[model samples]
Target chain A: MMLELISRNILHRPIRTFITVVAVAVEVIMVLVVVGLTHGLVTDSAKRVEGIGADVMVQPPSASVFMAFSGAPMPIKLAGKLQELKHVRYVAPVLLQFSSSGRLDIVYGIDPQSFALVSGGFVFHEGHDLQNPDDILVDDWYAKARNLHAGNSMSILEHDFHVAGVVEHGKGARLFVQLKTLQELSGAQDKASVFFIKCDHPDDATAVTDEIQQMLPRYVVRSLKDYMSLMTSSNLPGLQIFINVMISLAVCIGFMVIFLSMYTTILERTREIGVLKSLGASKAYIVRVVLGETTLLCTVGAAVGAVASFVITHVLVHAFPTLVILIQPEWVFRAILIAIVGGLMGAAYPAWLASRRDPIESLAYE
Target chain B: MEPILETDNLWKIYHIGKVDSPALRGVSLQIMPGEFVAIMGPSGCGKSTLLHVLGGLAQATRGSVLLDGNDLSNMQDAERTQIRRCKVGFVFQRFNLLPTLDVRGNIRLAQHIYGNEFDPHRFEMTTNVLGLSHRLHHRPSELSGGEQQRVAIARAIINEPKILLADEPTGNLDTANSDAVLALLRQLHRDLGQTIMMITHNPEAAAYAGRVIHMRDGLIVDGIPA
Candidate 1:
């Protein structure tokens, strides 16, 4: 019965209710899309790292933990020296280059034989792996995104390349071409972004990583486990700050809109509030009524926002065929939860003020 | 019989800018349980102010109000609210029906807050007597002035409160609606043996009450040749 009263109060003002609902929906969408895309970047990077089949990864000391931004190049000649170390089976030099589109369009320059050896799951989805210096292997998602099929000609980073066979999704980088070709294209032919070292045995990974770190004291080397952990960064230079800023802005948007809107609604219903007080409504009851209305509005808004986010993600993937956006369901759930909490918090102060209104003054309200 | 609603020279003053305007100037009155009383006065005569003080809706500047022996002046707001919820009910001149609610909803809102299991028999008797059973599904806008007033009466008595306070219960109605509303008020008083205190400017409306108390310039003048 209280629920019905609350629902009616909200429905009493159609335009105001709709505007509030849409505002909450937009905030929720921002939460989902921002966090969803971030997760996609992290998950894709982890997959690419694991697919390399290397027991350890080595990078220039100044390079970023996030592969997409690891621009400080390591000497390509270091791979041979690393492979000569005991327990070293193969050394694959990789150049991780970020396209202007950012992380979504990262270009991986892979030494094909060494990459195939380190990677355990390299099944091709459409076309075969990189066969020539100019051939590029695109992930299935990116392939579908960009309409790049085998035998197609494309320009990546102002350098012309031929499309190799599309690989299964998550096997490796979304866009992979010959290591040498990528190196020449970047005009850094003798420098690779990092080296992935494969150990002769699985258990030799730790010892080999320690040996390599000591040998190239200037470079940073870490076991695969540590590399993967570092890859999922919570504080990546400026990226963490950017994500936090976006989230805080989204929370503030949700909170302020709800607060102001509910406050105005309470003011509009001054007489009704008085009448409710005259009817013997306790302060707690008044607060509950107001908060209940906010909760109902938020629940509906969040559901609509979730659908809107999925639609937006669909349109984006279709529009940018090479884009990798994994809209994780858990992140959508988190977004909805965040929207609900922020909205309720926003409504609290207004509810408190409404509950404190004097019944006499309210009854006399014009 | 114990007085169900009483005031001991209650005074209510309003501060307007620099001036202190007294709405009630030490007015004392009481209505015994099961009696119907009317307070009659012109605009700003302190009748509404007195009604508000008795109803625990306003604080008196001097003296105290006792509802069924509970000293309202000393009670906390929540305590006063609980008294209003359990022992008192109000019918306003404007009908004051929630616009978004249908007739039944407006009547049930009080019981919902009272948190008592609604007595269907009393609910049926009240609505049937008010002739609002058929109009229960209609919103306030859909009802006539008399019907809306009757619905307000139904809401007021739904909880069977010990005292029912009404301010200008028929002030907004036509002559016929006013008479109809007064008739319903009288009928409810007789049927339920309920105590009622109403404020009105109309003598015809005051005639329905068993006792009439007149106020002039914020003070009550009793025994005026009615």
Candidate 2:
């Protein structure tokens, strides 16, 4: 009977109830898409790091990641010194460059012979490794996107190069050329942006990393495992703050809307509450009635939000094939939990006020 | 026999800023079990205030209301509420039936609050007594004024309370429905042997009770025995 009365009360005010529910749902969508986008990027970046197959990477001391397109150039001779270390199977000096053509684009320059070592390798879908000063490699998706194939001439960095091969997708780089060619073209001769170190024994990665740090005190050398752990929500500097701000905004939106709606409802139903009190309803019972209504609204709103998120994610993945989205089950659960908790917190004040109403006075209320 | 409902020198004051206007001033009354009593007074004579105090719905400013030996004025809100739930029932002039519930649902609400399952035998008896058997499925708005009052009465008695406090139950009904409702309430008292305290300003309504207490300026001016 309490449940029925609560449902009827909400149904009695359809317009206000609809507005409140939609408000909660919108907050849920914000949580899903904003957090999911950033989380997916972190996961994809970690996967790409693992795909590189390097036991260790060396970058500028303060840089978290060696972006071939943006980082300061390090001395290329550091690769030779790293090769002299115990368990050093290969050292590949690489340059990463970024282009803002249609969107952000990544350019990788790799030493073909050294990359095929146990530390680093690229599996080609067609054609051989770089065979010309102007030869280039691309992922299958990029080749299809740019309409390039083997024997086709492609223009990059204001120079034409033969499409040497198309590598499988998700292999770290969409575009790769010889390190010497990239260095000369970019005026970065005798300097590379980063070094990939492959160890002869995979289990000795940590030892090799420690040795590299001793040799090059000015550089930051990290094992692949250490780098992947930094790919979480907190370890990244700006991402943590972004998520925190967004989640707080979502909570505030949910809490205030539910509070206002439930408070107004209690006020409107003041006489009804009084009637219940006269019939011997406990203060706890009145509180339960109000909370029940809020929880029902939140649950319905959460379902709508989950559906909206799915549709948005589907459209995004279809429209932009390269965009990564990982809507994990846990994220959906968190969104629902936040919505319900915020709603309950918002209703707490109204429920308390309702419970405290004097029955006789309320009965006389017009 | 001890009265099922009793008030001793009850006083209730309404505070408008600093002014304390007394609604019930030193009024004491009692009605024994199985009695059908009516309280009659002018609008400002505090008949309703006395009724509210008797039913444990309101606490007296300076005295005690005892229902079956339980002191309403001395009890905490929860304790007073428990007495109302277990020992008393109330009917109002407005026919305060929950609009969302049908006749059956309204009657069951009291049962639900008491955590009691429906008693088919007792439910049928009350339905027959109130003439609400055929209108059980109708919502309050769908019922006539008198029918709504019947539903209220049915809800009040569903928990089998020791006393029923009715304040102007026929005030909103037409003359015909008023007579019909009055007669039904009288018949229920006779058949169920339940105590009833009705508050009204109408002399005609007062005549139907076995006993009538007349008040003027918060004092009983007369008591007429049937």
Candidate 3:
């Protein structure tokens, strides 16, 4: 009977109920999308880096783990020193340049011969590998996203380059160019942002990494296998805080909307509350009714938000093939939990107010 | 016989801002078991206030209300509420039916509030006695004024409370509906032996009660057997 009354009361005001549900749904979506996008980007980037087939990596001193943020600060000759290390089979000097012409991208400058030794070479899908100063290699995803093909001339960083080939994705960066050409264009001549090293055996990666770190104590040296393990949001600077701030904002939105909705509902049903009290409803019973109504709204909103998140993610990924958004089951469940907690918190005061109302005054309420 | 409900020098003062307005002023009353008593008074004469105090819906400023020998005035709010839930039922002037609930839901709500197991026989008997068996599935808005009052009456008696406190149960009905509700109350008092305390301004409505108590200026001025 109590459940019937609560459900009827909620159904009695459809517009208000819908608005409140939508507010909670928006909160859920915000949390899920924010967490999903950040996690997806990080995991995807790390996987691609691991796919580059490098056993060990060496960067300039104090370099960021995010390769896109690294500058070409290390001398190109550092590749020779890494090559001379015991158990090191090959060393590839790569220059990183950030581009934001039409879209955000990180361009990798690599010496094809050395890069092929370290990365086991790109599997070309359209044309041959880099053979000219202005030749550019794009991965399959980037080509599909930008509608590019071999022999297509594309302008990047205010410079035009001939599309040499489209290769399989998951190699480090989506766009690749000649190391010398990128170095000359970026005015970082004879400079490399990082070095990718291939060891004689996969099991020797950790030893090779230790040797590189000892040679340059201040430089960032990491085995690629270990680097993949460190690709979580917490390991990335500012990402976790950003996720936290987004989640907090979403919770605040859900809380405020539910608070207002329940408060006004209590006020509107003042006489109804009086009737309930007259019928011997306890304070706890009144609180349960109010909170029950909120829980119902939040549960519905969470379901809608979860479904909407998937739909929106699908649409986004379809429109932008290069964009990665992973909606994990754990995060979806967490988002629902967050929305429900926020909604209950929002309803607390209003439920108390309803329970504390004097039966006579409530009955007389206009 | 001992009184089913008794009030000793009941006083109810309304605190309006900085002033105290006394609604019930040292008014004492009593009603025996199975008696249909009517409290007749003009507006502002505290008839409703007396009912509220007797039903344990509101506390008195200075008074003691004993329902079946329990001092409601001396009890805590929860205790009073428990008594109200178990031993008292109320019927308001406006029908006061929960608009969202159907007639059956409203009656079932009272039983649920009483925290008792469902009594299917009693529910069917009460609804049948009130002629509300057909209207049980209808919302208050769909029922007529008299039907709504009947639903309210059924709800009040479904728990078989020790006393029924009604504040102008027919005030919002037409003449025919008022007479029908009055007859129902009288039947409940005589046939079911239910104790009823009703407040009204209409002598015709008061005529249905076995006794009448008249109030003026928040105090009883006359008491006589019909």
Indicate which candidate wins on DockQ: 1
Query: Who is ahead in DockQ, 2 or 3?
Result: 3
Candidate 3 on B1-226: residue-level lDDT in tens? 8888888888999999999999999988888899899999899898988888898888888989999999999887788889999999899999889999999999999999888778999999999999999888899999999999999999999999999989999999999999999999999999999999899999999999989999999999989432
Query: How would you class the docking of model 2?
Result: medium
> Model 3, range A194-254, lDDT digits (tens) per residue?
8998999999998898888888999999998778887788978999999999999999999
Leading candidate by TM-score = 3
DockQ of each: 0.84, 0.69, 0.82
* Least well predicted 10-residue stretch by lDDT in candidate 2 chain A: A64-73
C-alpha lDDT values of all predictions: 0.85, 0.85, 0.92
Considering lDDT, which of the candidate structures 1 and 3 is the better prediction for this target?
A: 3
lDDT of 3: 0.92
TM-scores of all predicted structures? 0.92, 0.91, 0.97
lDDT of 1 by residue, A147-232 (tens): 77888888878778888788876644678888888888888788888888889897999999889878878777888888777765
Candidate 2 local lDDT, B1-226, one digit each (tens): 8878777888999898999899887888778999999999889999988887777778889887878989899988888888888888889999988887788888988888877887888888898989999999989999999999999999899888999989999999999999998998898799888889999888899898999999998788788332
Please list the residue runs of candidate 3 whose C-alpha ends up more than 4 Å from where it truly belongs after superposition.
B224-226
For all predictions, the C-alpha RMSD in Å is 2.7, 3.1, 1.5
Candidate 3 chain B superposition, TM-score = 0.97
